[model samples]
Target: MLITNQLGQVLVQHVDYRDTCLLPGGAADKGESPAHSAGRELREELGVTVPLDRCLAVDWVSPDSVSVPAATRFPGEILHVFDGGTWDDARISDIRLPRSEITAIDFAEPAQLPDLLSPPDARRALSALRARLNSAGTVVLENGCPLAPGVLDRIGVLQTDRPSYRYPWHPGPAPHDRTVTQVWGWLFAPDGRVMVLLEPDTAVDILPGGTPEEQDQGDPVATLRRETAEEAAARFTNPLLLGHVTDPASRRGYLRYAAALTEVGPAQPDPATGHTYTRILATPEQAAELFDWGPATAHQLSAVHQARRQLGLPRAARLPVTELTDPITC
Candidate 1:
């Protein structure tokens, strides 16, 4: 069974027998359906009664495909993963693990699965997460690899660890006492999808703005324009300052903006990294999920959408995020 918390972190278990972490579940008893077994395992292992109504994925492993202890040639097995629903502090506090089998449990980020689990397990967990996000019901996998993957799968979303920053957003004027060192914008396209730049090294999603260069002459809009052009080969109009946040670590203000994308030029390497970014357009909600801003994501996204409406842009359709391979050419 695949369980998660409100923040989308997977609830994983640690056992004495296995070095890697495991999602909560065990083999099904005879005459028991997969869903029933999942519920039963939760009761026996964690002493919880989480409903297992949603089937997220089904995986089939081939014989001798993966090695395991106490087996010369590993036999094949069919695995069914069900949703255990999101748990809160009260529900998590009630958990009672059978120490003889499951030793401990932790809520792990999706990107942390690779380090915590075996390759196949990591792949299966990530695929199941995408399946849950997708409109399609259940995903099928062979050797824990998705047979029909979506955009998120193809681009390897959640493959890298996200930065931990929960800076409080001040949706008002920038503090006159502090220096606004950085500027970032959610540049919206005519279709209402916002632009996000994928970092070359980490592939993490980020807005295409940066520190205000001296040449920018202390103009946040100027910084936004130059940064967007250099990072994404994109230009925008009608830059609207949403607000600013004071980074406790840096003691500098980070400005936020909402603008309408005007034109996209050919892709070029960013001067800083000397590598071209993988740019994509996502709905404001989707962009919020890509960032690890905690609750502040909703606040920024709300402001972005409101700015979008003010700019006379339509709400983006609910679809998979789109990769802009070459915005001008594509």
Candidate 2:
């Protein structure tokens, strides 16, 4: 099963017998179905109970194609990979490992999988991940690469118009009074809806983002990750630099902005922002209307829509607002 945590990290387990890590599944027992076997293995290995009916991919592996030593290899096997759903921090912490079989279990990012798992296992995990993100139904994998078209292109570029902020600012040359740099995430949910945070008092909705600090070390993506965690209480993975926006009015400096497409995670209370934000999911059009910042917000959402189009995903619909709440801070 392809089990992932809220951070979009895949669950991999280390076995004492093997040097490479493995996905949290094993061969099915006699008279057991693939779904049942997946669930049972997860319970036995990670102590987490998640449904496995959402099949993501099915790979038919040949015995000769298996990368393991011939002595340890079995006949060709048909692997049924399921979507294990996203787990929150509490659920992740609740994972109980079988010390005898699984020496260690941790969620590793997709990019890190190559080093963590065996070659075949890494390919299988990546195929599952790509399927999960892009909603490619029943992906067929040869080794680890998808046999179908449009499943491999993951990164997307989104071009935005000139940066414009809400404040009364004008463009000027260097040595300007203000040089603002902000980072934001274009986080997408499994259902293809975009996640937005609503301001409690003003009721204006915005993306999960904020200004970078001195400690950010000049990495906008890092700032995006940190600020997103603080403001929206969510974690994301495979953040590709979609693009940046710069204020034309600022001659000396500009409001340097960067965004990335992220997989949506569990939402919690923002530890840094103090105020608990109201998390909402909406389509690009609905999101454009929700933003009180006017054209700037509209442009940002447009860029996101274009990115989605580039990824071969369906356009988001004009859906009603869905709110998930948390504790409020004074």
Q: lDDT of each structure?
A: 0.83, 0.63
lDDT (tens digit, per residue) of candidate 2 on 50-169: 867688888878788876689887676789889988777898889888869899888875667878887777777777765665554678877666676341322210011212243322
Pick the TM-score winner: 1
RMSD, one per candidate, in order: 2.8, 16.4
Error of 2 at 155 (Å): 7.5
- Which 10-residue window in model 2 sums to the lowest lDDT? 154-163
Determine which window of 10 residues in candidate 1 has minimal summed lDDT. 67-76
Say what the RMSD of model 2 is.
16.4
| Count of residue pairs whose backbone atoms collide, per candidate | 0, 6
Model 1: residue 325 alpha-carbon error in angstroms: 2.6
* lDDT for position 316 in model 2: 63
| Residue ranges of candidate 1 with Cα displaced over 4 Å | 51-53, 69-75, 133-137, 326-330
* Model 2 ranges off by over 4 Å: 68-72, 151-178, 181-330
